[model samples]
Structures are given as C-alpha cells and as structure tokens.
Target chain A: MTREPDSHYSSGNEAVIGWDIGGANLKAVRLSREGLQVVQQPFAVWQRRDELAEALARIAAELGPAPCAAVTITAELSDAFRTKRDGITFILDALQSALPETELKIFGLDGKFHHPAKAYQQPMLVAAANWLATALLVARDLADCLLVDIGSTTTDITPIGGGKVLAEGRNDPERLVRGELLYTGASRTPICALVQRVPLWGGWCPVAAELFATTQDAHLLLGHLPAEQCASPSADGRPATPEYALERLARVVCADTELLSQAEVQAIAQYIANEQIHQIAGAMTQVLSRVKVVGPVAAVGAGAFLAEAAAARLGLDYLRPATLARGAASVAAPAVAVALLLNEEACV
Target chain B: MTREPDSHYSSGNEAVIGWDIGGANLKAVRLSREGLQVVQQPFAVWQRRDELAEALARIAAELGPAPCAAVTITAELSDAFRTKRDGITFILDALQSALPETELKIFGLDGKFHHPAKAYQQPMLVAAANWLATALLVARDLADCLLVDIGSTTTDITPIGGGKVLAEGRNDPERLVRGELLYTGASRTPICALVQRVPLWGGWCPVAAELFATTQDAHLLLGHLPAEQCASPSADGRPATPEYALERLARVVCADTELLSQAEVQAIAQYIANEQIHQIAGAMTQVLSRVKVVGPVAAVGAGAFLAEAAAARLGLDYLRPATLARGAASVAAPAVAVALLLNEEACV
Candidate 1:
C-alpha cells in the first residue's frame, strides 16, 4: 500500500493498532485519538510464524495497552498445496494468541468486521480488510471507479462500483497465473520477465543470461523509483543494491557475464527500466479498459516509478497516498484510509 | 506472420524445404512451388545436438531432396549464441554431406544468401534469410506491419517499416527478457506463469502448484489450435503427437492430478485458456501501441490460438498463412510468405 499522511484523532485517546501484513513486510501503525506517533521498527514476514507473532507482540507492546486492534494479513505465507482459508486461520490464530486482551477484528470479504465466531461465514477477510479500508476512505467519491493498488509483490486492481469492491478474481499467486493476478510488482519482481532486449548507446542488445538487474535497479537509476523504497530488502530478505539487482535479474536467463564490464550491466538496467515502463503502462491500460475511470487515478504502494509512468501514459490525474498522508508518517495512506473509514462507520 | 494465399508462385513441380530450428523442436516443411504437394516434420531438440542433426537428416530422406532450402533458425540455432551457430553449421554441413550437388544457403538478416566463404557472418546471414523470404513476398506492402511469429517457447513481434525489417532487439532469449522478446508462446510454455487464479463454479480458485495444464491443452480443447501441428512420434521422421496432447499439456504445470477426474482437468484447462486469452490480448495491445499498421494482422506460428483470439478481441482482420499457402501444407503461410519472398529475390 502507498504511504499516507498521519491525521490526528481527537475522540478517545485510547490507542488502536493498525497492522498491514504484506507479502514482504509487516507494517504497523499505532495511533491514539490525540495524534499519530512513530513506532520505529522493521518486521519481516519471511520469518517463522511464531517469530513473526513475537515481532507483532513487540510492536503491540510499544503501543501500550490498546483497547482495540484491527489486523490485516497479506503475504505468500503458505505453500501451493495449502488453501487460503487455512492460511488465514493460521495467521489469525497467531495474532489472537499474541494480543489476547484487545478486541480483535479480523477482516473478511463480507464487507463486515467480525470476531472469530463469525469468521466461518465469510472468506477472504484478510484481503477484504485492506479493501474495506480503501473503500471506506474513498467511498464518497468512488461510487463507480476502479481501485488500482500496486504493492511490492502484486498489484490489486479492484473495480469499485456503488461504493463496494467489485469482486473480479482471487487476489493471490495461483490465481495470478489465471489472469486475475498480475505477477509484476515493485520490489521483488524478476527483471528477466519484464523485457526481452536491452538498448545500448549504439543499438539494441540481447541481455546475457546472468543476474544482471531488476526493476528496482532500473527505477533507482531512472530516478522514477525512490531510493527509500529501494532501501528495503527483497521479499526474500536480500538486501537491495545495483550489483544484487543485476545479479538476480541476470539469473532469469543463462549468460556468460563473469568477464563482462559494468557498462554492459548498466545497459541491461536501462532495458529493464524501459520494459517496466512498458509493462506498467500495459497493466494500467487493462485496468482502465475494465472500468470507466476518469480524471484522477489513485496510485498506491511502493511502486511510484510505475505509478508516475502510468499517470503519464494514461493522461490522468494521479493521487498518491504518500502525499496525502504526509504528516502521519507512521500510517500508510491505505491504512489511514481504512482507519478513517472504520472510524466514520463506528460513529454511525 | 499471418498466412497469405499462394498467388505468387505457380510452379507445381518444384519443391522447397523450410526448416525452423528451435530450442525444443526442429520444425521442417517441404512444399511444391504451387503449394500442392506438402510434407511436414518435427524433431525433438533435447540434449545431444548430434542426435538432432541425425533426426533432421532422416526427415530430409523421407521428403527427398528439394531444389532449394529456405531455413529460419530460431532459438539456439538462430546464430544468437556461439553454441547455436556451431550447431546450425554442423546440421547444415551434415545435410550437404548427405545430399551432394544441391545448393545449400544459410539465411541471415542482411536479406541475402551466403556460401561457406561468408559463413563467419552467420548472425547477419540468419536474419537476412528470414527477412529475404519475408521481404520478397510482401515487398512494398510490408511497410508498417508487425510480424508476430509465436512458436513453442517465445513470440517475435517484428515491426516492418519503410519496406525494411525494423532491427530493434536481439532475437534470442537473453534479449527477450529485456522486453524485446516476449516469452509467452503456444506450446510448452509453463502454465504457472499464465494467470494466478481460475474462476470455478463456486468461486475464483488459486491454481495449485502442481503439473496441471498448459496453453497447448487449452487451445486444443477450444479447437482453435490444430492437433496436426502438434509434435508427435512418427516412423517417417515427421512431427507427431508425443501421446495425447492433453497429457503433454498437463505436464507443463505442477498440479497433483495423476488420477484427476475429467471435470477437474477441464476446470484447469478453462483457467489456462483464460490466461492465454489475457496474455495474447495484452501482447497484441503492446504491438498496436508501438507501431501503426493499416493492413490486416498476419498471424503465424504454432500459437495461432493466441493470435486469433487477439484478432477477434481487437476487431482486426486476421490472416491465416495456411489458407494462403493452399497446396503448400508443409510450409505455414507465414513461412511460405517468407519463402516466396526469398524466391522472388533469388529470381531478381
């Protein structure tokens, strides 16, 4: 989800912890009714389930005793053989065990927040939580619109019609190969799959099979993707560097590049940048075709490079959660949007 | 390269051999000038390039010696790599040795044929051979056209502008990753990468990570992809089905279904078909954005299933090469178009 500005809440100063479980990172935002505060910590979902729970507990502890907590889990946490329901159950159980006293609202697809008792009635609660949050934030204006939320591992293109998230297809990897899931993402996407040729100064080049570069490296070089986002390690928890990106991307194919110069690697980076632009543009076009979205296109996630490029290509106004959620540095725009929606609903 | 009718060459007796050397298959076609008598063959391009050569030789013996050979070497034989060039050279040398006194010309991108004296310029030669055949058939009419050749492993979207092939990127796998080469193809492409979800009767499903289905299976079931074009085991050294096309396609994905019910397999096939359509649509849109072509799209290669689907979706005219080649059953329309173009240039 895209980063958003922190807004002050003045109602009850009781702290509420918001958790954004992503494929690669577990981002948490602790807020009280008074204002937003920073909880400086890093959480990796790639850790063991129990270890991850402990990390979440530590974050919760930092927030002190919170009266309520809203948690959303997202990631490639399960193997191919496992079902989403099973995966969701495992994560929810872990969250409950770690933070017992606080009232827990697990998100699901029914467009309602429910406790463990009602979990069986609805599926995709974790996925729906984020969508619900997104929906709640923009409900007034987005009666009939397409919500394109690009994250590190996958892009969620949900068509929102009549203030609800229009269900398209499953938003996971297996479904990814089926058309509903687009595999390209911001952080950890394989670069080899993006482009087929690299353009050199003189002419185009066929990239050698070696881990040459990635979309991150290309965006970093192109200045389209920010270094801050690139600062984070890959989904696999590998550090990001030009050398590492190149090394991983080169592995997409087999090439003898041990003796090759750095210039060749740079050329591959340029090619990847161009291809990323192309793919982002294509995906944006697909989203546009499915829904009749006009004017402003809400861009979210760490993939600002793609968002900016898509904005230019589609000739639409772009809204980034990062810009809107400026002061509230702790809460991402998607999380904030969700919180705001839930708050509004709580009052009603 | 969509198929065009055989109006250029009327000579009924003379036959020409067309060979497509790929990473997985050696596809060859022998056709009469009038396109009447035709013989098509395929050989598995597994390990052991020497065995591949022997397999081709056997096919040649079955088809008998032709007046001339028009060869288009893709993948490892496209002279893109040192090993590929050496392999092609070995195969051509063997062909010459097996059938003496016949003129053997290796195709290149220079739009010209070369003898052994100029064999060092193999890369340019292969491109020229492909272009020579392609250029001659269409000539002035080829401008502003995108030649989409979808084989087993990858697809080539070459733009023809100003009566010349637009040389933008390398026609190999490494360069292909750079976006200059689109990896999605008709046969043998991994299904896991197609789509992430499949819509079932109840809800959208995330495909399991096990050997399930492939694009080949989808196309075959849809009846848009012809079974005759599929590779199979044959006594006469021609392309024959390995067994059931469905079984081969099932091997492309990792879905546990050794004893899967027919309904289950069909569901997987449906998902694959959906993914193929999405990919083809996306790729076609990319080509349309890059170039402006006025004429009908010429769809060629084994993956015509995608091309046809793309054409239908885009509301564009679809030209099938086989329909144009008429009597030339062996040489697909796109290949025939290339061959006719080469023949015309030879006469000129």
Candidate 2:
C-alpha cells in the first residue's frame, strides 16, 4: 500500500474543510494545522430534502467553522430535485445559508474548483463530481491505477494513468455506459437488482422484485459488514441485526425463517454476496480492458472490501483506502480529497 | 373466443360474495339474483396491514353482506406478516371481524374450499391460491390451456390439462422455479427489475436500481394503460401522465427530460414495454415446454393485454378474459372465479 504524503495544510493558511453531499449520505472532512477531522452522517436527501439545510447546519456546528470549504456533490442526482440544475442551486443555497461566514468552492468535472456563481451557470460541470474528486486525489499519487470506490448505493471504477484521471465518461449516463459506474453497491442495492433467481432448496427460486432485502442484509448476514456498519435502513423497517437481516433476506425469495433454516438463509446471503462481487468484477474487467497502463486497484469507501474481492477475482493487486486517507476518512475519501486539494491550493 | 357457460346462480340460494384479497388490491365480486357486482380498490397491505379489517368492512358495506363469502388471497405473500401462516390468520381474523354473521370459506390449492380453521392450519395451501381459483374456473370450460393472469405486480402462468389444474408448483417460491409465477407485472414492478440497462442516446445506459420509475410509467406512456387505471402511486409522486412518466423514465438512466428528449423517453418506454412482454413470453415458453396438450392462452387481469401480447409472440391462440367473465369482471377474474365457484356450490 502506498501511503499518502503528509498533510498539506500549512500553518500559515486558515484551515479549509471539504464536503461530499450525497443523496443518502453526508461526508465532511476538516483539514487544519492539527490534523484531519471527519464527520459522516446519514441523511435521506430524496425523502427529506427539505431538512437538508438544517442537517448541513448541524454538521457545520459539529465541525466548528472554517474560512472556506470545497464541495463535490452527488446529491444533485437525487430525485428530490427535478433536475441537476435545480439540485445544484438548492444545495449551493443551503450551503451558503448554513455556512454564511465561509466561502464555498464547487468541484467540477475538470478537476478544478469554481466559485458558486460559475457552478450555478454550469451546473452539469459540478453535478455528481464526487467520484472525480477522489480520482483526482488518487491521480496525484499513482501514475497508473484504477480507483474502485464503492459507496452505499453505487460503485465508481475510475481509471487514473500518467498522473491524470483518464475517465471516458464525464456524466453519470455516459459513465454507466462505459462501465465506470455500477449501480449495485454494498448496502442500499435491492437483492432483486443483483440477481433474478437464487439457488435454494435444490432449485433456483425466483426472487421477488421488491425491496425485501438489500445488499446490507446479505453483507451483514455474511459478516462482510458489521451490525454497526450496516448504515442503511433495514428493508422491512426492522432492526439492522443479523437476525432481522436473515428474515429480510428470506423474504427476498418470499419465504420466512419459519420455512427456511438459518443455514439456508446463510447460503442465500453467501450467494447474493458472491453475485454482487461478480457484478463488480464484471464491470471492472470491462473498465480495465479500455484503459491503458492498468495498475493496482485502489479499493476505497464503505464497500472497499467488495472492491478488494473484485480485484482478487480479476487476479489484480489491490490497495486499501488508508493508502489515500486515514481511518473513517478513508471511507469518506471524496470529502478528504476535496479538503486536501483545497489545502494544497491554500499552501500554493 | 370460447364463451363461458351461463351463471349457475340458481335464485334459490342466498347471495354469495367472493373476495380476492391481494397485497396491493382488494377485489370483491358478488353473485346474486341480479347478476354480478364487482368492486376493485387499491389498498397497500404491506404499508397498512393493520387497516385491512377496516378496508374489508368498508368493501363489505359497499357490496352488501352475504350469507357466505368464498375468498382466495395473495395478500399472504405480503411482507407485512412474518409468515404465510401469520398472514392467513390475520386475513381470516379481519374477514371474521368485518362480517361477523357471514359464513367464510377459504379457497385452497386442492381446488376446493375449506373452513377458516383449515386455512389457518395449512396456510401454505391457501397462501396464494387466487391463481388456482381462476384456473379451476377456466378448467371448468377449457380442458387444456394456460391461464396467464397478470396483475399489477405479478404474473401467474398456470397450466391446466385434462380439465384439471396441472400446475407444477403450488406456492409462490415453487411456482417461480417452474416459470409459473413471474414477479414482473404490468404496473407496480420497478423498471430496473425488468432490465439492467436501456438503449439511450445511441448507447446502452445502466438504469438506476432505485425505484425512480415503475412499469406503470412505461405502460402509461406507451398507452397500454389509461391514466385512471394507474392505481399504483407514481415513483416520483408526480401525476400519472405521459409527461411526468417521461420524466420518471429518464431518471432510470439518472437523466432528466432536460437531458433526454420526449422521443428518447418514449423509446425507452417502448423498450421497457417490449422487454416486459418478452419476459412473460419467455416464461410462457418454459411453461409450455413442460405441459402436454397445450391449448389456448387465457389472458386475464389488469395486464391481460400483456399476456395476449406474450401469447401472440409465442404464435399461440389467445383468449380474452371476456371468454370467462364480462366487463370489469375480467380484470377481477380471481374474485369473479371465487364468486362463481361459491355460487355453484350454493346451488348444489
């Protein structure tokens, strides 16, 4: 694993924070003379978008204050807003209102931070740029590598070569076509989205196309994720424990624990987890085939373990998120990347 | 079209009602001296299972009380209950409370009706027996055929041969394996469940796994269903119109109308509609390969048109629901079947 260089936050410049405001999560990282401080919160933007400003205010209060903050966002893709332009404007408005004293810089697809006004005029350039932020940060260190950042709901397989981000798709739609974005993730993806049928009771049982269970349940049951780290809400609105997850997972095949033994449910979980890994691996292979100078895969985020599994399946070496960010900040790599990038600018 | 025999409701017997209680719909039909009275209501059982008793009572009040009510239910498959037994018990309790003076007979997989106690003891027998109720009714007329009943959220493909319900699988799980129960429906199924990617902007773009849109939007936009018939809630909580449907369809690819033209959105809807038909057709082929004496395909329910399309695609003769029931009764075939079957038993 390649370790990141020391903090670029010089003592002479005031500390600047970074925020990656996603549809389902809010990640904030503050870089100062002391060290890196991270705050991660789960906020359902699509359901409770009206509460975003208040949530942002609460995060701002917890992180104290900074003179400026750099922001990369995927929240613009949330269905709460009619269009990304509207989402970008709403988020920028909320950011300004929540952090009235701090200046805000919006990270764009071009790997540059622009003033809020410029972002408003060219919202598409800044929409869903969180992946770019992490990729740009990884590009700074690795001359050639693939950054496989798997979040709660989506995976970003960004390729970096020659110390530059070489992503062919600039937008989500294009990225999806190029296999750079695989919608299935470790937590939020519905089990039915991964596979239509699961091997059960000596037969392949078709799964219910409902949100009966998510990858969180499968991962939680299979020990890929702990109870605490199962951040997404249970599909059945039950507790996030393995017992409840097993019930939810059983329902994916329209059965309950009463009908299915624990061993059977565990097998189902294992199958789902394996299929999820295979899905990521398939996408990674498609991505790797296109990029020149294939390097080690940098697995990062809440689903970094899934990325590593995918990397292993492809017989490729993998790097942990700690190679780029430390501790919880590694899971919040985009937030840390923006903070570090902003800090470097301040020093320059 | 093979027409069904005249109603066997001998005026001597007291009026009988039949209820097909589904997870998303409550379809009630009354067979009295004055012909058939059908009532269909949308009730989200998974979200509000506790209100089921009240809903049943309200429907009873609307249809008026009967001496006896024969019921077939698919609501037991809802995740609201821990097990099918629990669901059956709860539904029976609701029925008893809703009609204290009425005699209740539960439809079973044995092509017979049993007392509520029998259903409670062997809930699996009556868990999803609505399909059987319809099949038995069709079996009375057609000696050999496939009963393709496509509701809002699921499609049941039951084969009947030699005037018997020759279904390979009894319950939902088993039926799924035998290609007798397809989870895809006409309206409520999430679009992502149908296909992982859609042809968009000269490329195949991955669809968002989120419930941003459903089959209702595709069928609505494609004119397969009228706006008033879109009983399911819109995925974006927008109006059930082609305009808003286009918006929702675009979001499946993480784009909006701003990025996608109406023609493009319509193309996407067309693709989804065609794929849904292909899915049913594929299942129909798998099912047909197993059964002997393959006969006409009787298309019924809200998605009878879809079933008809599937039948045509397989180059098989198709019969409309009207072949067995009339008017709206065709859409509420299960309810109508239970009513006719119970009425016949009453006459005997």
Runs with alpha carbons beyond 4 Å of true place in candidate 2: A1-12, A321-325, B1-12, B321-325
Candidate 2, A71-123: lDDT as tens digits: 99988888788888899999998898888988888899998999999999999
Once fitted onto the true fold, the runs of candidate 1 whose alpha carbons sit more than 4 angstroms away are A1-13, A37-47, A125-129, A141-146, A158-181, A196-214, A235-238, A250-263, A321-324, A327-331, A345-348, B1-348
lDDT, candidate 2, equals: 0.85
Model 1 lDDT, residue B202, Cα: 49
Quote model 2's TM-score. Answer: 0.94
Residue B132 in candidate 1, Cα distance off native in Å: 30
lDDT of 1 by residue, B212-293 (tens): 3345556665565567654433211223232344443332321222323446556667667766666666666665676666
- Candidate with top lDDT is 2
If you superpose only chain B onto the true chain B, what TM-score does each candidate give?
0.74, 0.94
